[model samples]
Target chain A: MKNRKIRGAYTQYKDNQVTPEDSYWNRRDFIKNLGLSGLAAGSMSSSALMATIDRPVNSGFNTAEPLSTENVVTHYNNFYEFSTSKRKPAEMAVNFKPGNDWKVEISGEIEKPGNYTLEDILSWTRVEERIYRLRCVEAWSMVVPWQGFQLSQLINLVKPTSKAKFVAFETLESRSVFPGQKRGVLGFHVLPWPYREGLRMDEAMNPLAFLATGVYGKPLPGQNGAPLRLVVPWKYGFKSIKSIVKIRFVEQQPYNTWRKSGPREYGFYANVNPKVDHPRWSQATERRITDDSFFGTKRIDTKMFNGYGEQVASLYSGMDLARDF
Target chain B: MSYLVYAAIFRLLGADPQEEMLHQLGLWTLILLLSGLSLTPLNRIFSIPKLIQYRRMLGLYAFFYLVLHILVFFWFYLDANLAELFDEVIKRPYVTLGMLATLLMLPLVLTSTRAMQRKLGKRWKKLHQLVYLIAILGCIHFIWQSKSDLNEPLIYFIWLVSLFSIRAYFARKKAQ
Candidate 1:
């Protein structure tokens, strides 16, 4: 999979690829549309807000394995901002508008530190579809076709100083939009709001490091981190923070949400190593999220660095992964 | 129940059906188990001797849920991979506790009938007290398996501890 040249530039992702099982997702979207209309009546115009977050699928990366349906990918989420329950976020984040001016503040040891709109930041580089296997720390996995530009593009544009040791990513903290931040995760209010995640400067500069603008081609819906989010293929899902509003190039090891909330369980370098089992569950295997006819998710053996070790292993050559994990 | 099966059939079980099923089964089992365990304590405290009559039914229902839980795990979770099931039972300490607790429940379930209860007499009551051990095992298994947010598990743990403490209080009163 080394630098395979793109064959096609624009293959319109025909929405016709969906299965009959899409009836349920349609029902959900129908309900969401009702809510969207109510919001439109109250605030913004209907055209401005999305009824169904559908975008043309850009053909970039190729995979023999089937991609998880766009509906399931968007409907089933882990954004703790709206709710901890995977299915609830879709319904709860209906009113969550990332707004016309979503600014991502580039701070710390960067040369050109300023608050730039998401569109301004994206102008630095081009977006491409990266079909990557996202393995959650919960031992469930999904192969997502992400629309993102490499983080290196932004890093190059901003130019981090030698003092920059780490790159921290922070999510939006408006409790009004994110109901879970206002309330708690299943009434268990533990994590500090504006979820924080970071990477070593070298890790941030990795070819695989991605700042995803969309999933399944459409601009990201509120449930799946609208506007922007990080997508690090090698690390556990939490390391790839959602709905990022701040990007700081820090000198010290930055404050990460999980590492702060659960120091023993969640480490800084959350590289997907199956050998290093999570304290809660064995990472030896993961349930690949396939919308099988019977909903029978296939359990497959997890690989080192979630099958991206070839590209990312050099980043942690001598360091003990087991200890770090 | 039938609701879960219907949900699965209609493809309304969300993203991971098997995981959701397993979770539901486990939750019902824990609920039933705790409810059954509470009956005797409730009887003593409230002087409602009739409450003792329902304890056997509650225990049986809890066991049934546990059976379904195991079925879901092997059939869907491991996809009838007996080797992997054994490996999980052997490898994970939490799984080991759960399996052991399940194994121990068998004898109690076997001797639950009226004829067997009559034949065993005093020994039946003694053997049934093993529910205390099973309850403790179940609580530990639940607590151990919890990832980081121990909110739910800790609640169950506290409930179990409180019940046991109440039982101990009754025991001391009997001694006095």
Candidate 2:
């Protein structure tokens, strides 16, 4: 509770400064729009946790114009320790330490593979704001204005080899930083630090896959994979691994966290395809987070690669998605 | 507790509270199923007699949630759009798996009563074994639902596998 103000400090990120008061009203409007009065109820009932849960769902976009250069660099997540619920990460990450001593290792099929500090990566590229629609595999979607650039441009500096068929990413695997790693929720062996994910060579090189440094148009927040993260727009949300510390361009496929746990369920290219339902639920429809409740809003049909067909559908054109999926 | 939680959710987020209520029911149902499945393992580890008593409630809750989950999907999500629902069930693997899991849970719930248990006698045990099958089906339902977001459901799968593995190893040991 002492550090609650830490979240309120609305320093400028790309000139998009949302005052604490404005954010508070925004949250109120969001809840009212969602038909949720839980914040007021929680306030009356003396439940701070529920009040927190009722926080304005960060669509991550600065709706007002001039494309505020003061974009908040970090997008706080709701990943909770109690469960791997979509919103849990953001809620539970409030107490996390924002360490400055972060160092990332870049290796594998690259010409120059070595350790690089967070500052090194940021110095390479100027952050740019782009509004993106994040469609979670759970059939929920949110539009966010993110700050970063094509990771390939940076990776190109390393000069990946011709044999570098796949580019795998990894995140720091620390219980102190990520409490979820400590629990035996899944049978993942902590052989190395930073949980891993990979993309096909071209996919990794694609302009759409951003090497994000900040979100909401500013420097990345500690809770939202501050310092750096990956944002693969066409894939499922998880593929955009956060809090990254390692980048390996390999000829062979990388041992991805989710895929290693269940290969039958999670494919390497976790693209958002309504046609390819996740054996347990249909992905044909997704709940848009911004829809006003007064209209009795319903799920809209999901498109292939989440409407990035023009840019990404060709990636899997020759391959049998059903079989590969 | 989850039932009360669902009621409270309905009271709070009034945007088709049934969907949210049903979502909670489905989640808790899976949790209880995993808990129920863990009974044998817990019994094996601690030799506790009381754990088995809760299995019935847990299994019934799983069934309860499954029914509610399906009803909400059909009524609210589907919205009496029978053709669309039918098309989805036929075309979508996830929807099909969900339906399959729900349909399989129906028989188990119907025969869950003390009268049915007494009437079936030896056959009741055979009938109840269907829970293991239901659990597997439920897991498939979740796995498919996850797409590739396997973090949560993988935990359930791991727990379910461990529980069933313990039961299997013990059964083999007992036979030997």
Candidate 3:
């Protein structure tokens, strides 16, 4: 009788309210309150609940930070290509389908430089869940659980030539599909077309460099950079260029979009350095966008290398971050 | 506006509603200040003198939003840390400019009442000429603070410049 009662002691409480909290409360709550049709998984096992249907073998990286809610993650994105406004993208891109036959071109100093289909590319790399702290230069952050593989795996498969000094990634340029690109305010392009980003050869080869194809164990929505996007955990979120169409292994430091637009404020080495403040705002602290009332969430001090310094600080060596930043 | 506050409370303002609301409030303050400044020109341009009657009200409302904007900053961003807020205003150039512009508004708002306006007479116009400086400061404050998008600030600057030119032309004509 007690077992059937769900909450043995708290009889009035609902099963969800009484469910004994494991350390996986965020994931459990996430799955339980997805606010999507996936809720039909109520009958499924909690282990399988993570992926909904297919329980693939995913030995993924883990993080202790509570993941941001699906509602917040999906709805709120800085996808300026779709819309300059954060809230507008989800609605603006509701009909946007990246399509199955999307091809990614690998050019420049790569040995096997060719156009690979999305399915073909998927076959080459292993996809796994990686809960990463996505810090924005705007002094805000979100902990997102992404399903992706190490970018190094793709780099290895492509086999960059000795001359290759940098890797440049470009966003899909479809002005027709993306309104922001088509007509910025009063016909001014808000930013340069074919939005781009780059990383040094070492940065590209780092174990933390990822190519996310999914978020929250589901295929990414168009607003959140569908198809595939870079996920450089230690750098600012802008470094993670989205909806990539091209990957170029170049001999020179590639021209990144933000740096091209605002060089004084944004730089190529946009490593999440607390000491290096953006010209307009301080990076000393970041508001972690989690479950809170409008003004309730307290801003936490921005960490050196975004708390992933142990893994990546050696990559910077003795370089002056302030100068590069 | 209260709509921004309401939208933020209901989560209608999207993720990071506080940030969005802060921007919205600041933007509204600028718009109101600009609108208030344009009334005389608007009256002259259209030959409708009645438009000048609402300038004081617009200025007061602009002051209201500016107050709300600062309160939100203290409440949400600084967590009411006066020391931190002080550090920001002192250290950060854009923040410093904004703080200065807000502080200058104190005298304007205080001497805005009808009895005070009548008491000062011609001195009222001279004291209120401080608005031109205030407008310039406000424009630069917004312009310098804009991280990447210069278009918005540039437009504000153009508007401020045009307003200054019109006000100067009127002043020169009156002096003649």
Over B16-127, each residue of candidate 3 has an lDDT whose tens digit, in order, gives 8788878888998999999999999888778888898999999999989999889888877887899989988988887888888888888889999999999999999898
- Kindly list the per-residue Cα lDDT of model 1 for residues B72-91, writing each as its tens digit: 88886676889989988988
Write down the TM-score of every candidate: 0.83, 0.63, 0.86
Ten contiguous residues minimizing lDDT sum, candidate 1 chain B: B145-154
Q: Is the docking of candidate 3 incorrect, acceptable, medium or high quality?
A: medium
Which candidate model has the greater lDDT, 1 or 2? 1
Candidate with top TM-score is 3
- Per-model DockQ against the true two-chain complex: 0.31, 0.18, 0.53
- lDDT measured at residue A302 in model 3 versus the true structure, 0 to 100: 94
| Tens digits of per-residue lDDT for model 2, A55-114 | 211322122211111211122143322234443554566665444345889999889888
lDDT string for model 3 (A219-283, tens) is 67888898789999899999999999999999999999999998988999899999887776789
lDDT of 2: 0.65
Model 3 Cα shift for residue B133 (angstroms): 1.4
* Model 2 iRMSD vs. native: 7.2
Better by DockQ, candidate 2 or 1: 1
What would the TM-score be for candidate 1 when compared with the true structure? 0.83
- lDDT of residue B10 for candidate 2: 45
Pick by DockQ: 2 or 3, better one:
3
